[model samples]
Target chain A: MRCEKSGRIEVSNLCKRFHKAGKDPLQVLQNCTLTIEPGKLNVLIGPSGCGKSTLANILAGYDSPDSGEITIDGSPLKGPGTDRLMVFQETALWPWMTVMENVIFGPTVRGEMSKKEAREEATRILELVGLQDFKDKYPAQLSGGMQRRAELARALINRPKVMIMDEPFRGLDDLTRELMQEYYLKIFEKTNCTTLFITTELEEAIFLADRILIMTFLPGRIKTIIDVDLPRPRNYHVLTSKKYLQIKAEALEYLIEEGRKCFGEDCNIANTMVDEFRRQADNRH
Target chain B: MNIYFVLPLFVILSFIFFIFYRQQKRLAHYSGISTLSQIKKTLTSQRFWLVILGFVLTIGFWYAAVYWLPFDAFHRLPGPDEVVIEWLSRDPYYGISIYTKEYYVHILYSTYRATVSFLLATILGVPFGLLMGWSRRFYEYSFPLVEMIRPIPPLAWVPLSILMLPGVEPAVIFVTFLVAFFVTTLNTLLGVQSIDQAYFRAALCLGASSKEILYDVVIPGSLPYIFTGLQISMGAAWFSLVAGEMIAAQYGLGYLIWQGYSLVKYPTIIIGMVTLGFIGYGSSAVIRYVGKRLMAWREQELGGLGVTYEE
Candidate 1:
């Protein structure tokens, strides 16, 4: 499929600070610059609380950066618009609405499509996400993986120019998570939508990205960008490939250094606990 | 019976029955049982028998208290049998019973006043509360005044309401509305505030206008709380209505009770109290049924895993 020329997101010199009462302001993001090319799956990997989500929120237009220039298709971004939709870390499907209603909400509310047309499109998208049979079910009725799929369907039905996924599969069980990742990869490949996916999982980042943007510990900025030359239409087999392992090792090294910096003294205590457990197991043997 | 009065009464009763029947059918549909089967199941359940046993025990206790208590006050109070007998009499000693037009008039007047006050409170209070929760500017400007006034009990406003309002009916209604209004407003405001921030962000990202957010996100998000508020407001309306009627009105259950007391007709007082309890219970049940119908999505949360019908 030929990718559309639109949906280029260029975020430059982004800075954000969070104010706390009776304390100094916390700088969450500083001098962050990245470009998400059209129809590419760009993944951002960072340590927890390293402001990766802050950058995603700014890009999605939920929160504003203190000083930054964010442009979509060469036009400066304003507040939230239909052109960019975010899939939240936690399921953001409207619990009161069924999967069908949730998916059709954007188009119907914006008057971009008639209710009949929106429902038809929503049915297709729900089918794409394997939620067609569950269209009338509420978000509360769905399992975590299913809810994420419904959320994806909701965003996809909008045909958003840029799709932002913030740890969308964070809470699913291991098997379900792996299944969802594969399912999501197939959808992404088919649509070839421009996407900026945020994750703390190195494996997930390497497996799904066309390019991986590694973020620094705090006052988060792009530490480095690793281009993934893996062929498209990939699967679980790619996880064991020679190139995948090399990329994972390099990404893990960077993440470990950043993780050490982020954890500081706490990291030493965790290591000590692990050492103690190993010693106890050796004595038992 | 007057045709004019009886016709309206028959129409209203049939309307209420129609709604009740439809609600039962819908509830059964959701539960995957027919209405008749559900009713049969409830009747056969141990819980139903336990409820009956509870009522019997309570009445038995009331009988024991009335007959055996040695206190002068206990002697002055009418027994359960005496009240029940008077309530059913065609020509009773207290001049109020099933056959009496005056008894129905009192019940109708009380019901009318409570319904009007509750409706008025809901119509005015929901929007006020939504604005208070939605806008910081509105909250800052009006919340303090609401707080200041809410602390004053509805009964405390009886004297002032009578003075300011044109007549006794308005005064009674005003007092009742105050209590219901405050309850509805506060609950609705809290309801709006309790919504997840992510839902708002999602709505914004979908390019929803402010008005769209208000309708699509704010209203539905707060419905559970709004319904809860309505139930409480309905109760408060009746509470304040009786108090207001006792002081200012010529006809109502409260007026009937006060009249019975002044006339030393103890059975009449018991009759009025029992009637009030039944009507109040009925009104609350109606509100609950309506709330459940509207918030069908919340059923799984409320009823838990057992009630969920998996496809």
Candidate 2:
């Protein structure tokens, strides 16, 4: 999906740094350059503490890069706008609103339509997400999967030019994750939206993305961008296909090499120590 | 015993009537004549009448309590009839006059001072709390002072207010404000602090300005706590009013109650106390009603936090 003539974006160099307690300053991102074309799902894949979420935040205009420019349609982006509506990793639907109300939030706030029209659009999107029956139910009443669906409905309801999803399906069970992946493909097909979806899950990236951006750990930079040439209308059955496995292996190889570089040989040993400390704390509680 | 049942019966009947009324209105609306007469016709029904009758019966019970209840130690309560009669025929020698309607007059004064002082506290305390909660520098500088001031009783401030202010009016207002200040401030701060950071990020993502973020997400999200503060501060202000007016003030309910106690006019004291209780409850009910309407989104959360009542 990379445009040859005039594409959607031009990122020169992005850098970010954070101050740490009792230590040297931590560099989270440095001189990362990546350009995304319009109407393609660009999945950013990496391990924990790899600044992938930070990158997503920068792209969504929630965070600014320390230095470097992100230009969309050949113009530098300033801050977050309805132009790039983000679906958060944690379903950030207003806990107070019903499923339908959450979906209509953008249109209502932007004054795009009358209240009645916004509600109609919300209802239509809820139906599209297969959540028509749960329109009046609050977020607490919904399961995590349904809550994610409601967030998706909310994101899609606005019909934004670029839909930014930040690991929206990370915590779900396997069955629900597969179902949501399928749903994502369907909605992407319908909207023709340029999406930047972030996830740590390799299989998920291969399944739904047009091109996957594999990022290296801390001070994150793009290691590779693997294009998925598999046919559309993808489902869980595609997991068994040879093309899917090949994409997964390529992503995993980059991830494994990055993981080794970032966390030396003692990663698992340190994690086990931390896990024991947490277990003791839990017992005390 | 039977009369006690009247209130709940009234509520249930009203509930049923409302449902029926809604159904009929829905029917009329579907048929496409959105006229006032049609809506009114649907509203006027047998169920509505039954509910009204039940409500009237509960009022009758209160009236009866005023008349029939014996004023001996066994009951230790005067009926509304006796209180009314005594109120009407009080001795002129005791500053009693028609215009004075001393009881109602005192009620008016108490209500005016409490409401004014409480409103001042809300305006000042909420923003202070917001600053204290939002910025670490503000919190570090302010929290210790607030902590020290909060536990001090309103009575403790009486000496200072009386010395500092020009008259009893300012003194009373000062005491009332001091009583409400810390609670309102603390609650507002907590309310602001307790809001999830993700909400701010989301608001930022939506291109909300700092002021817009504070108003839309922060204030609305923290309203339940603010209302909880209002509820508490209202009660504190009422309690403080009695002590506040007990100073050089001549015409407030607190003064009236104190005067009644000095003269051994037990009924007048009872009247004053009862009037204060009613005003306090009434004001709190108003706060609760407004809280319910504004924090309509937080009803479930507030309910879970043990503020539940059957609607």
Candidate 3:
């Protein structure tokens, strides 16, 4: 897309395990490997609880992989830095701070930029996120979608090379979710920063990504990677287009296969998913 | 000595009231209302009279129980009128009343000891709590001591405090301090623990330093619980203060009550109890007032109910 993002992230053979005190060690991410090209949007799609979030956390340097090497632009990616920022699913905008304060929290704490300069930068970024009107309101006072926008504003102000978002709009209502997806796509095209978005929503994955990585069930491994070759400035109308339906069907098949493997006596989750995908496939915008 | 303590208290109180009055006036003007009329209306309201009536009936029951009870079970109890009569008269009796310098001296001494002890507890305990909450090593080092010491009543420390400190006054203050200190430390620790993990992760991703985390995350995050702890600590401070006063002090409401008990001048005991009740209530009110001021964020977040614990 010819963007200005400066870092290339290479996560090779990443393996992570969580140990419980009185039980067997549980493996989460297994031999996960991927390279996120700079200035591109890459979405990781998988079933719920499939370690996509754990992978995102590792990539963002919030947690270390038990066995792996992560490199950013050929240099070893260190623990959390200004180079990588995360927007949490729950929108972790500091409740104690106004939107403006949350946006400037990074630079203010680091003192890398002067207070006035940070304030100016924060204001600019908040305006871009369409949160200029809510600059004085605390996160508690904002709606769920507004809170997500505020979080996006906070992350953007840091000017990170890679922004990792874990199900950033998962909790919004259906209407808000659709609007947020459109809004997010617009923001991503402008910033053109490398973004790795983790979500189970297949439609969201297709809409946001230049590349999509599908993962298997628990002990999650990268099943396959598909490139979304849709033209730029793709809107909601593209959902009805033939090429998008073909891609959506392909993604759905991969997900149904994975979902079936996790089925139990009580949970017909896979069958339900298949039916839902079919209904969505039939109902064109 | 009475004048020295009483003078600053008057000055400080007047200054506070002056600020409060100005704020009230400014707010009233902004709202297009008069403060005096509003206050007068509030004073004359049904709710106000109901509260007054409730108080009189409750006290009337106490007086009736003392005067008209059939047995000697309530013999030591004095009617409210008896306490009032003693208050208005001179006390070779060593009671709380406007008539005596001795009463003021006792009140001032108790206030001083309580103030010094409570301040020390907060200063020492809060940081200790933060350390324990923030670092695993600190929790390991101190948690066991806290777990052991916290459950034991502050009164239990009275004998040990008497042995440890050189003077009676210091011992008494030490006991009171222990009660408040433990409350602040434990509550501050819980506040830190209760903070969402997402905030810490978000701050780390933003490249915040450990020091920044302490101030921005730990302090603000734990503040709600810290305030809850302050209320508990203040109550404990009063409890320990009265216990120490009764046991070791030459003057105080507690000492007066004890003296009245020993002499069987029962109305002085009622005066001491009533005075302690007022002071305890006052101290707790002050803590809550400070809490409300510092936690204005929570007040707005919860829409002013001050009781919601849900995230």
> What lDDT does the true structure give each of the candidates?
0.87, 0.77, 0.83
Q: Evaluate residue A212 in candidate 2 and report its C-alpha lDDT on the 0 to 100 scale.
A: 93
Better of 1 and 2 by DockQ: 1
Candidate 1 lDDT over residue span A116-156, tens digit each: 99988888888888888989988888778888999898888
Model 1 misplacement above 4 A: A1-3, A265-285, B1-46, B301-311
Give the best candidate by DockQ.
1
Interface RMSD of 3: 5.6
Cα lDDT tens digits for candidate 2, B99-160: 25665677788888999999999999888888787678989999998899888888888888
B1-311: candidate 1 lDDT, tens digit per residue: 45544555577579867965776687688789999887677668898799889999998878877888676667778889888778776678989987799999999999999999999999999999999999999999999999999999988998888889898899999999999999999999999999999999888888788999999899999999999999999999998899888889999999999999999988999989999998999999999989878887888555553233332
Residue pairs in candidate 1 whose N, alpha carbon or C atoms collide under 3 angstroms: none
Please tell me which model should have the higher TM-score, number 1 or number 3: 1
lDDT of 3 at A102: 90
Q: Poorest 10 consecutive residues of model 3 chain A by lDDT? A: A261-270
State which candidate, 1 or 2, has the greater lDDT.
1
Q: A1-285, model 3: which lDDT tens digit per residue?
A: 223567789988999999999999889898888888888899999989889889988877778999988999999987788788888878787788788889999988888788899999888888777888778876777777888988998888878888888899997989999999999898888889888888889989998899999999878898999999988888998887877887887788788788766675454766687677667767754
Order by DockQ, highest first: 1, 3, 2
